[model samples]
Target: MAATLTRPKLDVKSLDPYTFLAVIGKRVIHPGGRRSTEELFSLAALQAGQKALDVGCGVATTAIQMARRFRVAVTAVDISPLMLERARSNVRRAGLERDIEVEQGDILGLRFPDGRFDRVIAEAVTMFVDRQRAARELVRVCRPGGMVLATEFFWRQPPTDEAREIFLGQVCPGMQLDQLDGWVRIYQDAGLSAIEVRSGPFEMMTPRGFLQDEGLVNAFACMVRGLSHAAYVRKMAWLMPRISRAVPYLGYILVRGVKPAAR
Candidate 1:
């Protein structure tokens, strides 16, 4: 098992929807959920013995999958102490401590050296920060000719004023979302080549998406855990309605690009 870190108590009410979902044992917390993740993996074309970095790793779910499925070495990083603790626990529980490394990291400024990894991925993370810098950092850490991939929320269509307000104003303040073309440009400007894109509706909160992402048993577990406490119940009540209001206008973009090989 990985070494345990100090677990900090999170105030449920104050947590953003993603963290709140993670707290309630929802393993897949990104925009397109498990379906998008599968698209990412397909685009990655991972190979045995490659080095992969998963930024904003949440609870190491994707990292565990990458290592277990592709036999790759994964360094999983998240900024939150609570998230790191949960990631470590999940990695250990999967008996993948040896395969996956869990640690603290930031997206805008990563600590890794240039071209250190063969594959780099960030799921629904760049929207929360300076996306250009974040995209550059993801590209920077990938070896020349290596792949960098990210999943992000985008406007599927023009959102209504009320829908936009409910999401960007209340549910996810400070989150920056754009249309599919805008997202493509961010990575293109970051110096990636041979870019590819796949997209789907944002369904992380929908009943079908929840079941698909978590599966039947885990979905049931998450619901039970969510309802087990008053605070959890209140948070869900506050969150679901707002999320529903915006879901109609939201979608996810999975963008893949390759760092240009040395000239």
Candidate 2:
């Protein structure tokens, strides 16, 4: 089969409110689902004794798991103080307070000494940052010859302009999706050599599963009864149904790049 390239046409800013709610909601409902955490660690190829950083570490699930399961020291950071607090609690609950460091910070402007981490892993974070700036930050904190692992959701094929707008503009705004080539280009431009990217299927559970049930149809019926578009809340209320439907068609792409060992 021929390889297909995808380009996401969504303005990434509109997606923030939804992303924030959705992330916090996930932790509230699931408290770290097994499938997602399992997939993250397996794909990251985490090893023992390696110093790792989990950027955008929502609830610190993967970071804590890495320390406990792999015996690696991890520093997990996120932009949200609420999420950071949850992560800290989770880390302490797991008796990993000595193994993982929880911090509150933005991925674009990380506060770490140069070449501090042997590995950096981010799941679903780059789309939220200025692409080039995010990439440079990831590489900057990683030691020379270390690895950066990122897994992001992308459309298997580009959506039609109408679908794109409904999915991005009216629905989930400010979210960026980069195809395989785009990721390679960004990593290369950021001075990461030996870039290796692999695309894979994601087994989504919560939202995707919930969207498929009869519950969604019933909820939509209730939503359409008195919905308006005058306010941001109204806008999202209208967009949520459409956005939910678009989830099944998306795929998660994993990209791994290495900082050069030496000149």
Candidate 3:
């Protein structure tokens, strides 16, 4: 649940996607969450029979959770075919193949018609896309007055000196960090209105381990397996300092916005 202070320069282009997903497995990020499934369901607030579209839905865990929890029809889309396949497998394993549909598609250009979805949600996926374009696509497909629930990595205050150096010096050569204001701009620029922003501390959801625990290392390793060995090592080193700093309250900006009823 904690925000990653600095990520290694892992390119993720070297490994097979399926193998990569297998490495990370179901323990990606926080598993099960600190709160019970009931509490997590409460946070989603999904209504029965509502049509849900998860943009960049990774491996379909959230989509399956939404269907099982709220009795909704969930359509999960990812640009990568391999990811879609993995998500499909998860849906079947959850016995939600009928409830959740896994599709291969791009976030910037959704294949669905306008007003096709009652809700559009994404988790930790928006950061990788063109925020403005992705926002427009999400809003465009959602029915008027429907909601868009998304979580993005954002900084409240700019990173401290040490954090900045780690990102620029050791992590990706020119990776830019997003602050709260920057995120708001993305939503605004994409024409979304009535946005609400919420922030919380990223504590260990389970009784035991925190995000900085070995869990993140394994998750990160799988995530960057596509990169060359040299890139992976360099990025891992940069993360050492931030993990040591161990900033608490590292979490995403939980944002909700609405599409105007009329065009």
Best by TM-score: 1
lDDT of each: 0.93, 0.67, 0.63
The C-alpha RMSD of each candidate to the native structure, in angstroms, is: 4.1, 10.4, 7.5
Q: Which of 1 and 3 is the better model by lDDT?
A: 1
Report the lDDT of model 2 for residue 181.
84
How do all models score by TM-score? Answer: 0.96, 0.74, 0.71
Give the C-alpha miss distance for residue 246 in model 3, angstroms.
Answer: 7.7
**Most lDDT-accurate candidate:** 1
Worst 10 residues of 2 by lDDT: 1-10
* Sequence-dependent TM-score of model 2: 0.74
Candidate 1 Cα deviation (angstroms), residue 70? 0.3
* TM-score: the better of candidates 1 and 3: 1
Worst 10 residues of 1 by lDDT: 1-10
lDDT of 1 by residue, 1-263 (tens): 12211222457789989888888899999998999999999999999999999999999899999999999999999999989999999999999989999999999888999999999999999999999999999999999999999999999999999999999999999999999999999999999989999999999899999999999999999998788777788889999999999999999999999999999
